[model samples]
Target: MRHDHHGRTHRLELDDQTLREWDCTVVASDPEDGLVLDRSAFYPGGGGQPPDQGVLIWGGVQTRIVGVRPRDDLWLVPDPDDPLPPAGTVVRGAVDDDRRSLLMRTHSGLHVLCGVMARDFGVPVTGGNMEPGVARLDFDLAEVPAGFKDDLTAALNTEVTADRAIQVRVLPRAEAYALGPIVKTATDLLPPDLEDIRLVDVVGLDLQADGGTHVASTKQIGRIEVAKVENKGRGFRRIRLRIAD
Candidate 1:
C-alpha cells in the first residue's frame, strides 16, 4: 500500500486536506465492522488528533459515519440505526466541514505554540491532545517564568498574524533525521520500522515530524487564547489553548 493508503482504501485527505466530499465505491460492509470504501477523504485518527465524522449517501439512503476504525481496512463506523450500504454500492462520502476545518486550525495553532516554546523557552513538548477548537500541550519546563501565560498568548497570536505558510512533505527516514531534531517532542515516539517521515513546517518558524491535518497558513488559525496553565508534575507544564474567530 502507498503512504496515502490504509488497507484497500485510498486516503484522499493525506494529499488534500481541503477535500470534504468525494465519490467512492463500497468495497466491504459489515453490521459490526463497519463500511470500507475504495476511496475516502475521512481522516483516520492519529498523532493525538481524533478521527473524522461524516456520512455516506447512496441510493437516497444515508449512513451517518460517527467514527473511523483503522483496522486492516479503514472502517467507517456508521450510526447503528442507519441503514448500511451493501458491498459494491457507490456512495458519496462527506466529512463534517465544521469539525474538520476547526481541527485543522487548532492543529496548526499547536505547532506554532510548540515552535514558540522551543525557540523562546528552550523546552521540548512532552505530550499533547486536541479537539476541534481546543487543545493542550505539555512541555518539559522545570519552572514557569513570571507572566508566562500572558507572554505565550501574545507571542502565539503574533505568529498567527505573521501569516506564515504551512507546508507538508514526506521524506525518507534517514533524510529527515539528517535535518536534526525534527521530533520537537521530548521523546522519539516514531516507530523504528517506519521508513518514511511526514513533516509539517511552519515556514520560517518550526519544522517537525507530524501526521495531522493543518490549515494552509498561520492566519487561518484566527486568534489563539491561553485558557489555562497547569503543573502536572515536576518538569511538566501543561498549557491549554482555545481558538476563536
Candidate 2:
C-alpha cells in the first residue's frame, strides 16, 4: 500500500524504519544517484530531529544515502557514489539501526515526560527533539522548582517499571479531537484533511497525533532523566532530558 503526500511515500507501513530491512524492487532509477524503492521505512526526519543516513544495497553494489529531501509526494536522496541500478532493479534499503533505535526510544521517552508534565505540573510541551542519548523539550512555564524536577524524573522512571505498551494507531480527525484536552497541545504533523490521522498512544497514559517511529513498549525506553531546564523566554522554559539502557 502507498499513501504519497508531504514527500512521505512509504510511511503508510508505519513500522520502525531502521530496524527492519525489507528487500524491494527499484521501480525507477536515476543516473544522478536518485532511486526509488517499492517500499521503505527510512525516516526522512522531522519534528526537529535530523534525517537518518545509511546504505542501500543492490545485489553487488552498496550506495550511501547521505541526505534526504522531500518534494511533492516523494522523498529524494542521493544513491551515494556507485554504479547505477537501471529501472526495475531489486535493492535492499537499510538505515543505521543503532541510531534509529535510539531515536525511537528517545522519541517515546519524551512523550512520557510530556505526559507527566502535563498531568502533574500542568506544563505542556511546546516542542522537542531527540538524539541518541540526549533530548530536549520546550514547555510553557513561569518557573520550575528544583523539587518538581526531581519529582518529575522520579515519576517517569516509575512508569518505565510498569512497562506500558506503546500503542500506535490512526484515527479520523474528529475522533482525534474527541481525545479531548490531553491532545490539545500536542502537534499534529498530518496534512489537514477529512482523512484519518495517525496517533501514538502510550496505552492509558498519553496520546498524540504523530508520524514517527516509536518503541513497542515503554520498557524499551528504560529510565528518563530531566537533565536540565532552561528559561527560554519570560514564560517559556526548555527541558533537556534523555533515556538510558
Candidate 3:
C-alpha cells in the first residue's frame, strides 16, 4: 500500500496536515463497521496519537464521526445516534480543527523531546503515548541526572524557540534505514515487507521514520513543561510533558 493510502481510502492527512475539510463519496457503510469514504482526511489512530473526531454532512444532515478504524479498509465510526451516509452518497467531511491542531502541536512536541534526549543524553525511545496537549515518552535510561526535570523543560523550550522546520518525506525502506544512526534509534519494529517509510524530520535536530501528523515548525508547539518523570523498573524512565500556548 502507498504511504498516502489506507486500503481503499486516500489518506489526505498524510500529504496535507493542514487540510481540515474536503468532499468525497461514501464507498461503503454499515451500522456496526461505519462508513468508508473514497477520500478522507480523518487521521486513524497511530503512533501514540489518537484518531480524529469530525462530522460528515450531506443533504442537510450530519453524521458525527467519533473515531476511525483501519482494518482491510479505513472505517469511520459515527456516533451511534447519528445517521450514516449510505454508499455512493456524496458528503463534505470536516475534521475538528481544534482537536487536530492541538494534536499536531503535542505530537511535534514529543519529537522535540526525542531530539533533545538523543542530542544531549544519548537515549533511545523505548515507548511513548500522547493526547492533545499532554504526552509521555519512555527512555532506556538507567539513571536520571540531578535536576533532570527542570533541565529538560528548559532544553525543550529552547528548541521550540529555535523554531526548527519540520518536514515530512516518504523514502524507500533501505534509504530510511540509512539514517538510523542519525536518528539514534533502530527501526526494527517495521515489517520486512513494507517497501516505503514515511519520515518526520526536525531539521538540524532529529529524524525518524514516523506516520503521525506534526506541526510545521517547532515554535508552533509553544511552551513545553516537563510535568513528571517516573521510574518503571530497571532501565525505564518515563518523562511526561505538558504543552501550552
Candidate 4:
C-alpha cells in the first residue's frame, strides 16, 4: 500500500478513479461496527457525496457493506448483524459499479452547473448535496430573473455537449489556494495543516477543490434538467438538477 504525506496509506481509489474493487488485508473489525481494511476502494462518505455500498468477500463468505464512515481511519460498515472478519484476514472488496457510476455522473453534472453559473452569472456556490441521479447547489444570489431556470438548463446542456475533459490533480495547498479553486464552504473549514490538496478541473470550464468521484468527460454527464429553483433567503438561492439517462 502507498502512504500519503500524513503518514497514512494513500487511498488507492484516489489514484485511479476507475477502480471499483481491490484486494486488501483487514486492519480491524467488529461485529457491531464494521471492517477497516489496510486499503479500501470504498469512499468513506464526505464532501456531500454519500458513502459507497459494496460487499466484502473473505473466508468463503460474502458480507454486504451498506455504509462507510470515517473515524481516525475509514471504516466499512456492513449491513446489521453481518459477521466481522478478523484482523489480517485477506479480503476482496467490490463497489456497486452501477450506483457508483451514477454518483460520478451526478457529481460531475453538479460541477458543470457550477461552471455555467460562475461563467454566466458570476456567482459562487455556497453549498450542495448529491445522490445517484440528482443534486442541488446553493448559490449566493439575491434574485434570479424570470426564465432563469430555462436559460441555466440550456447552458448546462451546452457544456455537456461541448465534452470538455475532466482532470484531477494534487497540488501544494498554497498553490491550490493561489489558483482560487471554487469552494462551497468557508475557506477556514479546510485544515490549516493540510499540505496538499486535491483539485478537480473541468478543463476550459471549471476548477474547484473537491474530493468526490467524477466521470472522465463532460459529455458523460448527458443532459442536465433544472427541476426547481428556490430562494432560501436573502442572498441565497438553491438550484435542483436531474440527469437524463
lDDT value, residue 36 of candidate 4: 79
Best by lDDT: 1
Candidate 3: residue pairs that collide = none
Candidate 3, superposed: residue stretches over 4 Å from native: 182-187
Strongest candidate by TM-score: 1
Model 4 residue 224 lDDT score: 89
Arranged by TM-score, best first: 1, 3, 4, 2
Question: TM-score of model 1 relative to the true fold?
Answer: 0.98
By summed lDDT, the worst window of 10 consecutive residues in model 3 runs over: 180-189
What tens-digit string does per-residue lDDT give for candidate 1 at 1-245? 46788899999998999999999999999998999999999989988899999999899989999999999899999999999999999999999999999999999999999999989988999889999999999999999989988999999999999999999999999999998789988789999988888899999889999888999999999999999999999999999999978
Clash count per candidate: 0, 0, 0, 0
Off by more than 4 A, model 4: 1-10, 184-188
Residue 14 error for model 4, in Å?
A: 0.6
lDDT per residue for candidate 4 within 142-162, as digits (tens), equals 779989999998899899999
What tens-digit string does per-residue lDDT give for candidate 3 at 1-245?
78798888999999999999999999999998999999999999998899999999998999999999889999999999998788999999999999999999999999999999998988899888999999999998988989999999999999999999999999998888887653444345777798998899999988987888999999999999999999999989999999967
| Global lDDT of model 1 | 0.94
Better of 3 and 4 by TM-score: 3
Clashing pairs in 2: none
For model 2 the TM-score comes to 0.87
> What is the C-alpha local distance difference test score of candidate 4?
0.83
